[model samples]
Target: MKNLNRKNAIVMGIGLLMLSVAQIAAHYNPNMPDSYKGFFMGTGLGIMILGLIKNKPKRAS
Candidate 1:
């Protein structure tokens, strides 16, 4: 249980970090291509989903 919690925390932290980086990149590069922005958005969302999955409780048999 403790290990699961720790893994979840790390996953969430990484997702937050990626989101911050994406935001900063968008802010600094106003002329960034749509494809680049789309890629970042997709990646950030994927990380967040992974974090959510990590935090989900396992069913007991």
Candidate 2:
């Protein structure tokens, strides 16, 4: 909770959401275009990485 914040939560939520959506789409509908799938995975991973960075606790200077 300490490291969690509004922005981080939002980013993590959206990132994970996209990933989940992508997964479900692929599982439920296997005929999806490869380009969109790659885009979803790429953006999702990038956003989650950003969330991880934002969620890290910073040392007080």
- Which candidate leads the pack in lDDT? 2
Score candidate 2 by lDDT: 0.87
TM-score of each: 0.72, 0.75
Candidates' RMSD to native: 3.0, 2.0
lDDT (10s digit) by residue, model 2, range 7-47: 99899889999998898898888899988888998899899
lDDT of 1 by residue, 1-61 (tens): 3556877777777777777877788889999887787787778778878877768788899
Residue 7 of model 2 has an lDDT of 90
User: Residue 43 lDDT in model 1?
Assistant: 86
Q: How far is candidate 2 from the true structure (C-alpha RMSD, Å)?
A: 2.0
lDDT of each: 0.78, 0.87
